[model samples]
Target chain A: MARTRLTPEREGELYAAVLDLLREVGYDALTMDAVAARTRSSKATLYRQWGSKPALVVTALRHNKPVSLAEIDTGSLRGDFHAVLQRTDDCQMEKDSALMRGLSHAVHESPELHQALRELLIEPEMTGLDELLRRAVDRGELRPDNPALKYIPHMMIGAIAARQLVEDRAVDQAFLIDYVDSVVLPALGV
Target chain B: MARTRLTPEREGELYAAVLDLLREVGYDALTMDAVAARTRSSKATLYRQWGSKPALVVTALRHNKPVSLAEIDTGSLRGDFHAVLQRTDDCQMEKDSALMRGLSHAVHESPELHQALRELLIEPEMTGLDELLRRAVDRGELRPDNPALKYIPHMMIGAIAARQLVEDRAVDQAFLIDYVDSVVLPALGV
Candidate 1:
């Protein structure tokens, strides 16, 4: 493979192209050729930069995620959660959800993709959420020994994904707030 | 099109073939030709009976689901949930999860399949769970006006699905019980 040096902007364009194709055709149907054609880049360049479709898709998803959760301190756990949930730009959320839905099947079948998703996308966000929750524990807003703590990410993120999958509904801020107030907060004994 | 009278046993065989193929190849890669070859049935017969791949896959999934939630009364809400969660035959659960994972991507892209899944598979289970929760409310185990009542199905089912998707873990009886005790019960203020 010929090595190609891609600028940050060029890399972003490739990522966008991959995500667009992912949403349009899904993981199984998407091809490196299509991504290269869409971005007007050679397939060799894409392969050289990302190595494979799963690697490219994972990198794309990671690129699209919020860079930092450090700015999400709202002093209270509920406020912080609501802030984080609402932090996704509305336009981006639609695309991200579509990309996520598109990747769901492939992720299960491919261990490499699944591991990359956990390591690159989910783990980082989870680490951020965990940090926020720890701050709440420090503030006496929650019990340190609460078993619910282990499942908070599952509950909140899962609820959103489940609502979308089962009900075909978009999870708006109102729904997130209600979820936090009624389900998450109560589970935390707040 | 050749008119074929499929016996009950023949229909079961067809459903099994579809699900098995779905697990092995996934929804995108699964083909009517493959199903026909697997079941030793004509492609014309499959199309005549199920109309399309999505239709056949959805029918197969619906056929595999537990037929009745009527027998799930365990007197207590927690017991009922545990019973329902554990209701799937263990061997079947593995196959079903694989099938579900395989269908995840297609479910989002195909509205007809999505609607069929919600109506045939999800709604029925949600109805059963809702009925159980109502019984709990009547027994004064939970408040009728509690906001968490609206999200019980999402919480329990979502937590299980989320665990599988994110953590790649089997949601066994012990995990469900702990989830109920820690997350669901606390969320419901029990």
Candidate 2:
């Protein structure tokens, strides 16, 4: 095996730098050199750590996102979805949300990046959401095989992310409320 | 004013070449030289017409999208959404869809391109969807102020586009049916 380098702390610094650069330059213009310069790390350090631009960008995004979900016990599926989507709204509108923008550009260009992103940023959060929905089904809130559950997360975030990238608009709390009340609650067959 | 040099047909040919280059190479690797070669036009000719890469790419996207909506009287809100979404699915999954990919990448790097794309591609489609929804409300099939209606078209198409870009997946007839049953009808309070 070639060697695994970078302590978790060092990785955190690198990701913070990447986040700053993403906000300043957006994804396509973000350069590894700028990341090294910002983090006071050598170019060799980044190459040794991440191996490629896509890898580095992916790591940075994964780092920025809340990969694990809070335990959902709001006592109802509708309550849980509203809570989850509320957190989603917060993440999308974070103070410096270059991670979302970077992932949008990266996914569009590279399938590898897209897959990694789907696994790291999208899948984990949704796995938690899926668990919550499964609990709802068990509780008879939805059909046992309600297919809409499969695509709901994709639909909710997809709309917001696509709007952000295509319209250059920022998501906010009010929009999330409207989205959940108007889109998700109904789509779940609630 | 300088005399208009390239004929309309020649301009169309060059724009078509830009789209081809975008599909083949993506925005990062695409260049005006490649476009000139692809179209069999001189570099000078391209510059004289488009002036820059963003302008050229934006024009190509604008020229390629079929913006005119089909005047269909499906006589129901859900029916109309299904019809329109199916039409959009066909356009989104076309083989030469690098235009979509390139535009997605271009928007990441250039806010100007993002805004232009919204104006040229997203806005036209969204406007048609909005008008369709408005008519449905007038028919009392949907509540006039249902917030979900505002986001439904975006949600449906966003799901398709995001899936296509991220998962190498495209929207199909079955996906459309699921969307109507789960999202459209519920949002209309049916």
Candidate 3:
């Protein structure tokens, strides 16, 4: 329904604006009024289009993902992983990480937002990632029952979340690439 | 210093109160006013003891750790890892995880909180973890030049942080032990 209401370029612009506002004002402080004013749209239009702030924010995040992991089959799992890092630049990754850190807290308090995030952003990526890993197993890279398989999502998310807590740095391309090459690959015996 | 102002028991009571408030209301909404009310201390005394809310909260988290990872030396890395998990009950671990999740977002907005968390909670744990890993390497459990060594913190923290995001569950001891047994240990070639 929303897709039909706006042109593709206009929808892209609206999503970008939503994310920019989210970065400037956190989820708790963010309001529909601010989103409308920033995008020069009316509150009614925003409500009609997104239904709610949580859904809007989650949809924007889904729209902004640099690459869908499902589309990444580079013939090698390592190559696929590297391809993910290459799709987004360091600055974008830092912004995305910051946005995610902000969202991580909000999700705890609001089940609706959590549900939207899982449906619109997290689950889709996870599905794509599942396929990526399954292919690795299919290629004899990792045993099907490799216990590490279940924990890959945790390791990937943690790599970003802990960087700020541990080293006080953003998860850049180099650090992530190194993590994949060293920690993830070695753990998987790839 | 704050240490001299109160007995250890009283100081711990105050820190426990601080953490309770932090979990109930996130860092942004938590205030010295609420803290003083909860602990039956004056606002002036609260400031006198901890200097600021961020400092006080970070100190509380440090005080609440179930076990200091640095003190763990169970003759092997596996033993030490398991030892780290045994010190805390699952309920407490879930609480700490929630508390940490609350603080994770707060640290993004407040440099003071971020600095205090790193200094009080993160750096100390990291120092202990570094020694633990070094001991493992010394015992020929891993190559000193092993690339995975650098990312162990990432993996460890990631496991906890990612659990909620990926699987929507708390990090229980059973799951954590298995993670260490399967993912972390295997990654290190242990």
lDDT by residue for model 3 (B104-156), tens: 87787899999988888878887999899889888888788877887877888
Give me the candidate number with maximum DockQ: 3
DockQ of 2: 0.41
Pairs in clash, predicted candidate 3: A158-B158
Question: Compared with the true structure, what per-residue lDDT tens digits does model 2 show for residues B1-190?
Answer: 1328777787777777777778778876888888877888787877777667776787777776554443655888778766655655555656435455455555767777766667766777677776777777778887777667667655765566656654567656666677677666775675
Colliding residue pairs in candidate 1: none
Interface RMSD of each: 1.6, 2.8, 1.0
Candidate 3 docking category?
high
Ranking by TM-score: 3, 1, 2
Docking class of 1: medium
In candidate 2, the second chain superimposes onto the true chain B with a TM-score of: 0.75
**TM-score of every candidate:** 0.85, 0.76, 0.94
Identify the runs in model 1 with alpha carbons over 4 angstroms from their true place.
Answer: A1-10, A29-52, B1-14, B28-56
lDDT of model 2 at position A118: 71
Which residues of candidate 2, in runs, are more than 4 Å off? A1-11, A21-60, A85-92, A95-97, A108-111, A165-167, B1-15, B27-59, B85-92, B165-168, B172-177
lDDT by residue for model 3 over A29-118, one digit each (tens)? 889999888889999988888899999999999889867898888999899999988999999998998798778888988989988888
Task: List lDDT for all candidates, in order.
Answer: 0.79, 0.68, 0.87
Model 1: residue A23 alpha-carbon error in angstroms = 2.2
lDDT of 2 by residue, A161-188 (tens): 6557644667667766667777777777
Better of 1 and 2 by TM-score: 1
